[model samples]
Target chain A: MTVTPHELLAQMASTFRHEIGPAVDEPFAKTQAFMAAVILSKLAGQLQAAEADAQAAGDERRAVVAALRARLGSACPARLGDALTDLGHDGSDAAWSRLVGSLYAERDGLGADEFDALLGVVRSALRARLDRALAYAS
Target chain B: MTDAAAPVETRIAGYLAGKLGADDLRLRDVQRIAVGWSHETWLLDASWTADGVQHERGFCVRRDPGNALLREMSDLGVQFDVLRALEATPVPTPRAYFFEPGVDVLGAPFLVMEKVAGVCPSPWGSDGRRFYEAAAGRGVLPGSFTDALVAIHNVDWRAAGLDFLGVPALGTDFAAREIAKWRSLIDATGIQPDPVLTDLICWLEANVPSTDRLVLVHGAYRTGNLLIDDDRVSAVLDWETEVIGDPMYDVAYVLSELNRERTELLSNIVERDAFRRRYEQGTGIEIDDDACRYYQLLYAMRSAAFWMSATGLFASGRNTDLRLARTAWSIPVVLDNAARALGY
Candidate 1:
């Protein structure tokens, strides 16, 4: 049996959007059908982009970690260092969350200028990641 | 006595008959309305006779689906109490009739109240926007909208027994408490914490503003949440997130760009300066732009929490509504906006 998930999803998306949703009479039901189409289409995009997104994410993660490391130098708080490892070893959404928390927690110690400098690096990487997520969502 | 085997209309008719002590009670126009994500609302006309007198009334029923968005936060029973408390107040709300806390009746907990006469056009739709724009030119609804909000903010919470909504301490406790509430919701939804969200939350905490006065704050106040009749706000609806907190919380909601579309008019109805002048005059509270800015970010967090809860409901298979499923995309969208607002 041939397994084509993307084709199946695209078919369902089109069916829901063009056929099922328009055919429905009830307001909520029609909305639900249209929303199903939207979700399915997004899912298709996300599944297709998974590999490329992962590669881009990995490259960005490594760059962000290196930048943060270079900025931190001797000033890297233990909590922040732990957060930095999640970028390399763990590589999860939660890694950046933890890094952000640590950055704010250690802000007083790092002082205003250094904290702002490090945050700029994190923001660039975050923007790129958000852009990728947005590409698949719409 | 009614059973689940009966259709919803029959069961509700039977239940209302018993409640009203009239055996011949009947319901008409028993249609579900798209009111809010947290509840299944039905607007119906119920009629019966007692003591040789005829009676007719429109009823609004809000039913909790158990797995609706922010299920942990919004309680229909509390809403019933809140409505009853507002009956004599300046706030134009539906009179509370009954609160069914058990599942034996409607298959879920629900509240039935007077269905106030109004048109609650959705702010997101073009038709609705045109309705508001026309109403704005006519100029009655704009003033009516501001007056409705003023009444809500100026309501005496303590005297009106609304203190049950909890009171935050004098300082930045309101902001901290709000942050804690939304953060807990985000954690409960089990959405993987995003860096932008974390950054926004951290910024919100560090810049927590002190509130001088605690007034009843309608957490999500805007045009769509209002019900209009004859160019006046006949009823202030969507009473899900009312709180005994800073008035600026609601003010910030009014000032939020999230509520309006491409229109320069705030909420697609009222002029911003006109609203501010009217609101400040009515509430006796100075308009704090800085506090409004702060609460705007807090609202961003709250908005993210809503999308997370909605997507969680769909993902867990607890809800089959595709609208909930579609909101999964909104999480990233809201976070992106929040990140931009935080200068990310």
Candidate 2:
């Protein structure tokens, strides 16, 4: 852990691509080695931004969930309301995912206007998250 | 893993000799082809002497790699059976020969079939796109692509002994079944929940479309799955995901933008109007636009399931193929597409 993780990844990638890849004889095996090197290089490039992005995304998700819950109020399905409450103020990625699933799964029985309103609110937040993700991924 | 000292060639020759009833069977020039993510395909030349006559043939042996991309869903035996059933039809397929389901034979199940001679251009890579671009101008390949898919959709799967693949009964069973199938695979991944995927699944379940007609559906019908020879579709390969479902499932695949790159042409091979006209005329079934749209979303979900399973396999150390590791990036990319498809 002492060495910069990105530097270590860059070195490993270089070894795989420049040294180990050339020595592999089998075509498929050779492709695997080179592809592993490419993935490592990608990891090296993305390492610096990963933690900060996760934190930011978490904050945005909690805000969105709170806004949606206030709008739902007593209309919220008991199961979904409980799931969201369990995530507390700072929701993990997996919990957010589960909450989304719960929300959609409960959408059918809701009145058309209520469902549309809920969807609009959720979609806006989803789009925001997606934009940030795409930017980071690029 | 196979015994390296004896060689796969020796093992193959031995297997063929027992089945062929010839002691002098010879396997020549065995080479593993780097295609098919789920199965290992080996191309080899086989020769034998029987009744004082020499017989030679080229064969492809597809073996289960134990931890393939879609290991839980695909079966080598089922593929063999499907090929056997299709042999009597006009559907372009390689003739499957021997099938072994037990892992005792070569440490895994495998199926030996006639190696259809053709080139399967990858739909993703630049060179593959160029191959289709050139072939599109030639005119013959595009027509052949349309005709081959039509042949598959026109087949009477029930009469052809393909009922072994369960038939989805009445109304929206087909759509529901497909969603359930993929959901099972998602559950198998044992990864953290994906909210977008869960929402997509709910949406799919809520809006299941009614199936007007059922036929033999090639689950992943596209430019990459077809084998081309002499500028014509020589064979339709990759029967692993074939199912008895709505014809629109296959149509949606051809219609999806995933198969095309920098080209307005469908599958980067045929013009859209041309493909639609030919398919409608050949199959005599009007293109149901709504049904196709629904199946397109289903395809997106299926694609997401594939990436999740692939990434999970790598993370769990079930398999170390770099392709699986690389799929980790594809998971979000596909989920993003699915989210857009759901209008989120």
Candidate 3:
């Protein structure tokens, strides 16, 4: 009874191909329809995995902060240490939802350079956590 | 838009008359073949009567489109320059005749070039086995695809007169440059968080390997991009992404794809040790394993990032190339491979 975004996209794509696509005179309209289907399929796949992946990523980030605290001992910079401590405590789904929301809100405000720096920080934290996990498992 | 009948053809004919240094030149049977994401390619028939003889020719015009991904390289003159220089080399490229960089002629930068007749392998085509078979069956190509790649790498960059092109600063520090460029591309597109890709990029940066060897790298060299006839490469097309950087990047690109296919033909085509030895023999450069692995991982990451950016572009309506939208689905697969290469 309820149609999600993924289902709606698929329905629209099917309608376009069956109803509007045949009447279009554009040379590449058929190719465009096929491509739209491909994209819809990918979106469907992403919708299936996005929530689980986000949760896993948040847990992974928290683990990295704990490992960083252990590795830094007492020499870690005060600002970075404080940020890590804060991130470590706020590993709940609510925090992740808020972070995602804030990112969307600030998406246009952040320039390319600033966004890259932010991504770099997040990536570094994730990498450090992955390394710690590998070492522990090994 | 000009009338589809005689007026537009006559205008184009007039433009060519000036360039051809002849009178009574005319264009006939002009039709739009396909509009590429970057350029609009059209097939046209041209004829002119000079010195009591009639001459007819079939040629192609590649003109820039609005909001292309490679805006900086949109100048047909630059493409012409590269293709002209490559004429004397073993590299397979289309022969360029005239390059018009100004909008005064056709409202956009355009080039007239000799069209090579061949079937281009589609990366998204479902018939993967057929595609690989056709490529492998090109008898003129070397038994080892690496040999052809070695020939490309061994090209004299200085002799090619590309020094003026200004190689990237990351040429000397390839790993750093590779990471930075892709990161910049991702940032520019402003896509949503792709956790798998983000994780892979982090893994690649941390696992950077040390090496000093540098060679000409075809940024997107792979089976799909090459034109094969009679089991040999007739020509290597798509120089838009060419750069002088880590040679391992190209090698890793081929190897990573071949690894995915896992076919006996590909396996037998180039044994790891023999391929390296042959490449060194041909190019006089030794292959570095650690650096190759690092670049191989980098190539995968670059592919993932590029696909993500393309997806974002289409989704946001900045560009609406169906090919880019289709390619976005492969980003996860590429990221997974990059992660595997990084031993994550």
- Looking at model 1, residue B47 earns an lDDT score of 90
* Model number 3 iRMSD: 10.7
By the TM-score metric, which is better: model 1 or model 3?
1
Calculate model 1's interface RMSD in Å. Answer: 1.4
List of clashing residue pairs for candidate 2:
A97-B195
Error of 1 at B331 (Å): 1.5
lDDT by residue (B1-344, candidate 3, tens digit) is: 32234454565677676767659887666877546566677767788876778878766687776556654433567777877877777777777888877776667677887666554555445465566655555533334466668778887877987655446554346677668877887777766545545555655665566556556677777665666555666667666767677777777665555343545443223445556677778787766666767777777767766677777767778777787767655665565555555444
lDDT score for residue B15 of model 1:
88
- Complex DockQ per candidate: 0.75, 0.55, 0.15
Tens-digit lDDT string for candidate 2 (B24-103): 99888889875646788899988999778899998999999888888898999999999999999999999999998876
lDDT string, candidate 2, A1-138, tens digits: 488888899889999999999999998889999998988987886785678767777776677778878998888898778777865654565676666666666766777787778767766766766665555343
TM-score of each model, paired residue for residue: 0.96, 0.93, 0.74
- Each model's lDDT: 0.88, 0.84, 0.62
Query: How close is chain A of candidate 1 to the true chain A, as a TM-score?
Result: 0.90
Lowest lDDT 10-residue stretch of candidate 1 chain B:
B29-38
True contacts kept of each: 0.88, 0.59, 0.16
